[model samples]
Target: MNKLWGFIVAYFLRWFPHGLEPGLRRIGNPGPESPVLVSGNFSLTLKRLIRSLVGQDLWLLVANSRGINVWCAAVGGMFTHHNVIAAIKTSGLADQVRHREVILPQLCAAGMDVKAIREEAGFQVRFGPVRAEDLPAYLAQGKKKTDAMSRFRFDLRHRLDMLLSNNTMFYLIVAIPLAIFWPHRLLAFTLLFWAAAFYLYLLFPYLPGKTGWSRSLYSALAVVLAIPAADFFRAGQPFLHYGWMIAVVLVFSTVGFDAAGILAAMPSDAEAFLHRLGIKRLGSLLQEKTLGRVALDREKCRGDMICYSICPVGVFGELDPDKKITLPWQNACFACGACVKQCPHDALSLQPRP
Candidate 1:
């Protein structure tokens, strides 16, 4: 019951930070020679790491990331060299480990400064695979990551997972108040909400483009078609059909806007809209971070290859092939600003596109 309840909270209220104490934990019979790994204090992330790397003899260092998962925390500037430094120094990890190196999650490459962590914490940072499940293979191969391990995935399972886990809370919140006041339309609202969200999610990959316009257009199209379909099924109930049409539109308005925050690598339309309205983000994913362009100065490119290794998307290509940084898959840039943050040579810059 407790584990099930934990999953319910982790899945539903994940929008809020669920922090664990920042400290060191031993997995199995970890010794001084065992590998030391690091992650944020987000409870779910740690649980997954423990579950994935179970039976491994290692030390896990939990850093203070304001309870955010590694990718989000690192990109948002909460998880960094500073947090790792604190975790290492305060956790007394040095005495417990024989080596001077620690493995961080690869997704944190967006903000974690490898050099800084090395200099300050006296620990070399080797970024691990993108997913926790890949950790065993990563460790098995002497911590060498393959191309498959570096690139993040956005398949149907991940897309639907985000739909079910992240945004379901928003729907519940919206529905409850309406359920209290307009109790008669509760069922209609529920049906419309799921229908709109589900249809969009099912066809998310086939959506026209990676822009807010495509989503908004498809959302309107879905609601528009839904009225006719509902009417066709109930030819005599014209009044009921119109009522549902209105309900569908109302529910879909929030759904499309809400989708701006989902798993697609596209920039958040909701954030951009809020930014235009003179509202600022609460120090999370800044709208400018996504709206701005990331430019690389080849002259400043010392061929350090941090950008090549750090990009969650396969935006940067392998350095060995060109002996220089390349953006072969540039359009796939999620604009998380990870490479820009960790660029030792200051070669990459992010600015609003003119």
Candidate 2:
């Protein structure tokens, strides 16, 4: 009965026309002696991780992370000491767990200060495997992660889930039109979904292009060109009539391109390429940090918090009564140039890091 309800909920969530966000789960509880595992409350991560640990007798200490996954939330600074401490205190985790330790994903180290967490809260943070699947093995083997467990891999199965599950809205809406008008369209759509899914998932690393976008555009163009040729030979018709097929090919192919951002693995190949390009440009611009620092001269800052508001990284802090604001934690800047754009007086300059 419980499994049935869970399936229903998952399906309803997939079909529902709403944006995905993380939230806390009020789930079944385990005894104090049961090991407590910590994770972000991102709905997708929590649901899948909990599903993976279905048979285990454990307590999940889901920290409120504003719906971000563990690694992302940590790096983005939303899943911080305040959130962890607040979760522990507010969730009454002390009363539910016998041990003074909680297992957290290793990737979370970037955002979280483990030492601070320990000092503020008595609970010692235990680093687990990078992926949640290693939890059972690590837990069984007395809390040690094997090197194999820590390494990240974007296998075919992971890609399929991300591509299909993340943009389920696209599928569902497309399906309705096909079902009503193009009754024979369902099979073609399915094949297109899985084929592009497999290609993006399995062949993305080897795809013959620089960026995922470039790869996608070229691949799409090739298919678009070939479809008319195929149609010409099949129906003995001109390419003009089959222009719709080219549109179809382009649409599906570019969907995979867009999926690269959200579906691909961390430090995603697509993102990595962009990062590499950005790093090169920044390195050239800074000239070894010899220029002025990229900072707010408080005298020039109007307490408008434009830098704080426009930063994609959530790096800037609110202005205090003393007209002071803070930058990201040391060395945490991604150098996206958003702050520089937001500065009205050109006060925020990209100075070399000292």
Candidate 3:
């Protein structure tokens, strides 16, 4: 029963807040024979990966990536060397696993520098296939990845998962409210929103050549046309009512805002749309005085810029001639913890605002 509820929660998180990571299987004792595999902590991905390794015996190291799935966290630069190190240290990997080596997911390579992790953490890193399903065959054939294992795929099931994750918040917070308050008019509007969400989710990959702007505009226009038609068809009484028109506009506009978040190519595009709709401000907020400070233990730093370069907000500055990293624009820190992931010495990290 507990496991059943956990899976339900995991399914919902596929489109809402992130899910838990799967557990690791320590293959062999402290020896050269044991192969240690690393992966993200996304509950769904972890489950899929572990399920793939059912027949094999291996050590799986699950990194803490804020519950985000592997590819997303890697591209976002969250699952880097420091994070791997932190996981290793906290998990007591050194004492448990005899070999000083770790196998990483190939998809995560972009976010990590193999040489850096090897040098700083004293562990050799090996990259495995893009998907976990191929691991058993790859391992059987002298631990190698076949061409099939290296490929990345995005099929119907994958698209639907993304669709659900993107609009879970919308269905819960927005859809439910409208349905409860204005059941009659909102009923048609709600149906239209789900139809649009599902349609866009499925059709997005094949859409004609266009930018996010063009796509969003087309979607907005479609919502504008369809909701009114839907309302008229649903209502039998006097159709051209002013209140009805207002409700239609409200519903369409809300759907547009939701679409921007789901469909925008860049986070900035979503921000712009939300701002235009007066949904919320787009800029990141920090308690100005509290956020800019990075506590650096100079004595502890090994001159690793894991935190220096991976900053999405450009908060970390360039390395000095003496090789010391400087954060001249420390005020820019949103405190996202990118540096903490890169710092091998565990020297640089965010301190709570006093």
Candidate 4:
């Protein structure tokens, strides 16, 4: 029953921080030579990691990322070099581990300063595979990550998971009041919202837009159009009520706007477009300036292809194997800093558009 409840409330749990007890945890029976893995203190993330390492002998260092998962926490700036260093020191890891190396989730690379952590914490940080499930293989393979393991995927199952995480709370909040006051309208809107969300998630790749904002606007417009068309079937009655249309439009637009974060991959241009729209609605103005773009230092680039594989968008292209790489679609760069951090040779940097 406890497991069932945890599964049911998983979506609600993602919104806030959980499992904030930051310290060192001994997983299984570990000697001083056992591997030490570090991760965020998000309860679910910790739980998942624990389950994955059920039989493995190791030490787990839980860092306070304000209860956020490693990826999101790092991107939001909550997970940083300070958090990792604090965890290392406060947990007294030095006394327990014989080696001076710690493994962090690869996704955390974007937010964490690896060099700073090593310099301050006195431990070399190695990034593990992107998924916790692959930890055993990664460890067994001498801590080497393959291109497939490093790549981030947004397949159908992942999209469904994202849809639930993003929309479950909104549905519950809106459904309760309507269910209490107007059960009929509650059912109608519930179905509407569910359908709209499914459309957004399932058809996201095919959505006719370059940016998240544009795709969301297009999807919202479809929902708005469907309402009037459905009403039209009721002949001899008003096909479209102005007030109802306005309410539907507002709800759809509000939900769609969330695509800025919920969408599997968002480009930098889309983020800028959403920011402009958000600021303008408050009766303010934004003087547009060219934002920074990712720049490659050819001399420093080892042509390791890590950047090409890890980039969410296909920003970097290979000109020659292990020799040359070119930025064909530099404009699509989201500046997530994943490539910059993962690059072994310090070949990549973000430079402001001049």
Model 2 residue 220 lDDT score: 69
> Where's the lowest-lDDT run of ten residues in candidate 3?
282-291
lDDT of 1: 0.76
lDDT of 4 at 232: 74
Steric collisions counted per model = 1, 5, 6, 0
**Candidate 4: misplaced stretches above 4 Å?**
1-9, 179-184, 226-238, 241-248, 268-274, 277-293, 299-324, 328-332, 341-347, 351-354
Residue 48 alpha-carbon offset, candidate 1, angstroms? 1.0
Q: List candidate 3 stretches off by more than 4 Å.
A: 1-9, 14-24, 27-32, 95-98, 146-148, 219-354
lDDT of 3 by residue, 108-151 (tens): 65567666778877788866777788887877788676555654
Ranked candidates (TM-score, high to low): 1, 4, 3, 2
Supply the TM-score for candidate 3: 0.62
Q: Score each candidate by Cα lDDT.
A: 0.76, 0.59, 0.60, 0.73
Q: Please give each candidate's TM-score.
A: 0.89, 0.60, 0.62, 0.82
**Candidate 1 vs 2: which has more TM-score:** 1
- TM-score quality measure for candidate 4: 0.82
Model 2: residues with Cα > 4 Å off, grouped in runs = 1-34, 51-58, 75-78, 95-99, 173-194, 231-238, 262-354
Model 4: which residue pairs collide?
A: none
Which predicted model would earn the best TM-score? 1
